[model samples]
Target: MALLSPGRLAALHQMGATETRVLQDKPSDSYERGYAEDVDHIIPSPTLFDSLRDQHLVPDDMPAISQCATHLELLEVFHSLRNRVIQSRYLDNAFNIHPSKRIVYHRKHRRQKKVGKELRDTGFEGRREEKWKYYLNIATARFEQWIQGIDTAMNDLEIPPCGRKVLPPLDVLVVWHAFLLNPADFKEYCLKKRLQHVQKIIFPWREIHEAIDSTTWRFTVPADQAGWILQTTLLEPDLLHTLTEDSHINYLARDLLRNLSESRWYNLAANLRQANDRQSAFMQTIHAAINNQIEHRPLVENVQRQCIFVDKMHAHRWIRSPAVQGTLTRAVDKYENFLELFRLYPNKFLVPTLDVDLVWHTHQCSAELYRGFVVDRVGRFINHEDNISRGTLDTGFTSTEEWYQLRFGEQYQVCLCWYCEAILSAVEEEEVKDGGSWEAVDVEEIVERVGEEVEFCRDLEISRQKGRRLPRWKHGAGV
Candidate 1:
């Protein structure tokens, strides 16, 4: 930057290039910046200045830019002709200008190197706590790899091994297991550590507090056994064992099953979705048999029970909801059944009584019909409050990638993918994404158009308010 032409430097500054500035006082050429101290350079290249001026059309801001470089006279005019040519080519891709193809998009992101590749010390006579982390990393990595369907630890339950030293407490490891497993839902540190509340059954409070007191000497598990051990503990609880299935236990088991590279869940999810498409109820009932394979039944039951309770309480509001149009009466046909079942079995029953309008569009006609319905009806529901299909309108188009980009800008594409990912049947879109384009709508262009529309709408709002026409600039200043 110091060697750039005065005009070029000022133009960059105007276009928001970062420059080192002296806060207290402007530093002189002699003032030492640590990074510059070791560097060596050649004499100013006069040809660069001439070449830059000749080949590249100089910007209008060059005069002002030349003044900005007044203090940088001693700065060498740097760069080879090729480098300068490449550099000067993209100056116009500044703010408020739509980014150009000339500007680099999709850079290869740099990531920090992973840990635990280094060999651990042979002896235990070291910083036990610090060494514990080496093993913790191994355990975490194995579980993560397992989750991602990579070759991982042998025991589905255990953490991987590290060096010869004390390990992190079982409590913390269990929390990590839950976190790495349920990346969503259990996001908060406090919420995750809440699972540490379960650790008391395996390692008592006295032990946990002692580990806290002397973190360095804490007893750690083998990296491989770390994950497996938690599952063993989950199996150990007699009280939870009494239940046919427990929610917490099911959740932990689900995480363990996810990392099982040998497991057929992913293949089944894809295949079962096909079976589900042909006959939704058949697949829905068969779901119970499938969850038993992964021991995930309780988690599903727990979520369903919760939704059922909420729906039961809010029956009047949504049973004949203004938010849903079709078959309002038919959707809650089970309302009478629900009342009878509740009388007999209390809270043990759930009658699927909502989202009737938000029908699985695929089931309605065919995949094509669903896509058409999304593009037409669901898209129209965007700004219309009176329109039914609230649940469908909100969650449906999101899977298609249109609603997200329309409501939020292109930057939110990642967030939208994460949000509607579970429901997205990428039928064709998956291939489109792999080919480097997923969006049907140009989000940035849409945002600009929407902004214009909003500004136009403001005129109506302004007209409703009282205002007097006045001079563009009022004169009470100097007078």
Candidate 2:
């Protein structure tokens, strides 16, 4: 994308790449009928009108007039045309009585954003996404080959090409056809699937539905009564409607006690109904509380105009301080080079540097010693009373400006370690003070408070660090 300019890209077109050809489409094949047909026929400038022919499908009868400017637009043309045909098919089929089958359509299907992600742990990633991604992989591979072909063709030309080269509309469509011909392109489409039948509503809903369904034998073929229970209590349009599609137990168990006229469901249904009532009432209360107690408006920070906050990317128009992107570009040296230069130097003369690989394995104990040193230094900075004379400091450590000046030189580092410390403090305070309330301390407010504290401490010098260590429970982690 960076290689091609907008002017060059716009000028590019695949002229005379595809010829008007008869599409050899057969009925049984679902994929070959849609975009594949359009590409095979090599129809140009196909509008919405051109798409609908031969029972609302792309027909080969239309003249090859429509053309895509680029391979990318051609791909879009393929999808937009194909989706129109397939989506109509689905919508039309929706009228046909869909049998009582447990179709597992994902409610929140998403792609795992982290590249080379696991096929498992499908909290968001769904089967549909898997199928589409698989198809896209095939298409991308085909497109790469097509681009390679175009490059080869350009090289064959006698007159030397200058700047970005353009491919005509026909070339774009031809590559698109190659993309569609890739077998992975149409694997496992939605319409081809027939979902597995759920044996019974299991667990929570299993016991509930079974208590109604199986108990039909206990009362001399109580079939209509069963239908009534399902339709009214569970809110299914009919008994044939599959409840497993979105199995919400509370909604399914509505009016369960009233429906459970049978003696067997008496005790269990009674207990369940009471719990359900409480849950329903509590849901309403939650909604009401959210409406009254929470501000729905998007929060904008307006007050704090002049910040010298560190941990950069804090851009404000009125801010006095400039943002520093980084302190050290290359802080670590190669182990052999570093050792050759400084290993013979006296302990007092040498500034310490971490040989990380060595610390990770051989000299691991040294890491713990360094960790204790930092922890002690931070502990002292937080505990000193003179540093925090205004409001009561939280129990956990926050980096003050005085701490910064004492440890790292005064203006050398604008330490906003206070933000991290405040976040930890807020979380701890919520767990203790919030009780059942869900409202948490505003993180922005913590930032503002930290700013105020830093403003106070930036000028003043204060003594930090205690002389000795006291006993406390120590926690350790390992790689």
Top-lDDT structure, candidate number: 1
User: For residues 38-132, what per-residue lDDT tens digits would candidate 1 score against the true structure?
Assistant: 32221111222232232113222111111111101211111111122223212112101122233223434457443334343443222222222
RMSD of each: 30.3, 34.2
Give me the displacement of residue 335 in model 1, in angstroms: 38
Q: Give lDDT per model, in order.
A: 0.25, 0.24
Clash totals for all candidate models:
16, 12
Model 2, residue 5: distance off in Å is 38
Tell me the TM-score of model 2. Answer: 0.15
